[model samples]
Target: MHARDSLDPSRSIWHFIAVHLRRYREAHGMSGQALGDVLDCDRSTVSRYESATLRLKRAHAEIIDRLWATNDMFTNLVDFADRADEGDWLLSLAEFERRATRIRMSDTSVIPGLLQTPDYARATLMAGTADDPNSALERRMSRKAAVFDKENPPRLTAFLGWAVLGQLVGTREVMRDQLAHLIELSELPQVSLRVVEKEAGAHPGLDGPFMILTVDDRDVAYTEAASRGRFLMDPFDIQEVAVRYDLISDIAAPVGPSRALLRAELEKYS
Candidate 1:
């Protein structure tokens, strides 16, 4: 996932376990309520466990293993959960980005997270089905803060599709504010912003948005769809995406023209 993509480490461990639980449950044709009954917990608890909102206890894991007939997956999950850290995943990304020397990003429908304004983020959060939109917005904003912390910032290169600049994420005023923020951010010395015009013709990134984060030792790619995002660490996949990104970069407008394009779009909202 991108540095801005939120993942709770504590929840991730539990999420991994929960996925196995779901697999085992489905394999046995068991409903959540039925599984909850076996574990002597409420059905909602089972749901929460599966969703990674709550961790599974060893006793509960044992019960699930017994009921689902899994050999040792539950036991392994219990051990993994017990040793999981409670740190926010964003912090780890922040640390990595801070130490990283280069960052490259591409966005198709909207600005990438690190370059988003609060108004843009709020609109994005409000558009989501999240139970706590405000908290989600806060988390997103916090991630953005890490990129511009001033202590040690990575060189940022962002390529945004022309369609993204035209998207009215919120009210015209909000979009205007967002575009202005984008213009300001693009002017930062360490940051370079480019626009991939709609008429630039078809390209590999026509598939979707992705980010390449480069640290001293390794490079990681993050891609996302509507509901979920993934971190790509395999060297081969990263290299492939990197080549595609470089191709896209070649056709995108340079920084100056990109800023002008953004400014012109922002003017429409005024």
Candidate 2:
């Protein structure tokens, strides 16, 4: 499907702006950095705008319209910006987390967000990018505050791939700190940590990692790829994926065995 068709007009204005801007840039053969140069900002700034980290400005929207020679698109974006819900996406996610009585996640690569220490998050972000490592690290660190700062956080049940436990993300000291953090989080009364050992046979989640947030009225499943993240709200799809996740969890190690696995992996880094 085309990128433009993916946008929902009822969503935040930034979402609308980002979709169109990305489409225009791709059509014009303009790399984000090239566009950033035209806008007198850094490449990462362009990325943040696309990611809706930075708010879109009216002037910038006008510039983009002029550059792309779009007749009414610029005016529409400017009007949307004036009354756009500020940080609506993040607010929505935060509300989901807050209202959720339970959060179940299955992760194959990196540590789950609520369990990550700063050092571990830094290492993971750095490994994925060719840009400024510090900036990437900072962005990741900023995201963690939402999960860790709450006084009454949701119950968290996380199943990690054994590879994540075995992988050394940073220096030995950093790795040690990360494991310690995980161990501490696991001890929380509302948290459950499990590991799917490498020896565990094929399972439903072998395809990829995903998270399910169980709120008051419904559940939402989230999946992320290299360049995009999708939130699935359709009840049928969510129900199917939730069933698959449960089967995968059942086939993996139980909580007792998973904690043992984590302890052994921590020793390797120590």
Candidate 3:
């Protein structure tokens, strides 16, 4: 009955670990609660790991290896996955968004993709001269379904720069709908939209956009640049990204005022 039972091990290295971890635990006659005790997490966390909904950390793999006498097989697999190039960065990021228990995004550029309207996304993609602009736009628009159209969606807190709200993307109507969408998403129980006004001025997020996803009690960060994005899994890197988000959040407008600002910006297009 566990969702993990349906996971195809060939999907990714994480999936391979997830499907096999459950099998190994069951073979050893260990209950999820018992395994959770060893992992210093709850039963639900163990279940998430088994479902590959939460990523399995390398340190956890080592611990499992020792506890189960698996001869470091899991450790080696995690190492291999880590050593793999960023070519699969988007795949990993999609997985992170789909399964993250908490997500923090800081953007000083355009509206964060998760909150962008269809036309806004298209405009941005077209402006970028994307390799496959249509496909890219489709993917950007689909994150709403992938990350939100589920039983338990991740709690997302997005901190965006003030310029993002005023800077035009597509057309007046596009910007209007996009700004309206920001307000709409902010009303959700799990979504927080905070705007950092220009008056806030210089800040850590001014450098660029980054995201931190908390999954399986660990944090993974993704930093974006003009061309490529790097996924950061090291504790230090994740902490750095977390610190940056917190700093940016420190200067963001409160929720009520943020909504008021969003509504104010939406009117400009009217």
Best by lDDT: 3
Q: Model 2, range 1-270, lDDT digits (tens) per residue?
A: 222343454666756677667778999999999999888888866765664434456677778878888986866876866555333544445445655667888888888755788788777777875377676566456555655567767778888888888787889988888888888788878888888887786777767878888754357777756644455655677888799788887877887777777788778876
Q: What's the lDDT for all of these models?
A: 0.75, 0.71, 0.83
- Show model 3 residue runs off by greater than 4 Å: 1-84
TM-score of each: 0.67, 0.64, 0.76
Residue 208 in model 2: lDDT: 82
Candidate 3 on 1-270: residue-level lDDT in tens? Answer: 445655667767777888889999999999999999998888877887787656678778899999999999989988887677555666667767876788899888898887887888889988996899899878876776788888989999999899888898888889888888888999999999999998997999988999998865667789987766787755677788888888888889999999999999988888
Query: Could you give the candidate ranking by lDDT, starting with the highest?
Result: 3, 1, 2
Candidate 1 backbone overlaps, count: 1
Clashes of 3: 0
Model 1 segments more than 4 A misplaced:
1-95
Span of ten consecutive residues with least summed lDDT in model 2: 1-10
* lDDT agreement of model 2 with the native: 0.71
Residues 1-270, candidate 1: write the lDDT tens digits: 332233343545655676767667778888989988888887867765664434577888877777666776688767865555333344445555554668888888778878888888888878888778888788777767766875878889988988899888988888888889989989989999999998898877788888788754457676767755655645678898899899998899999999899999987998
Clashing residue pairs in candidate 3 are none
Superior by lDDT: candidate 1 or candidate 3 = 3
Q: Cα deviation in Å at residue 54, candidate 1? A: 27
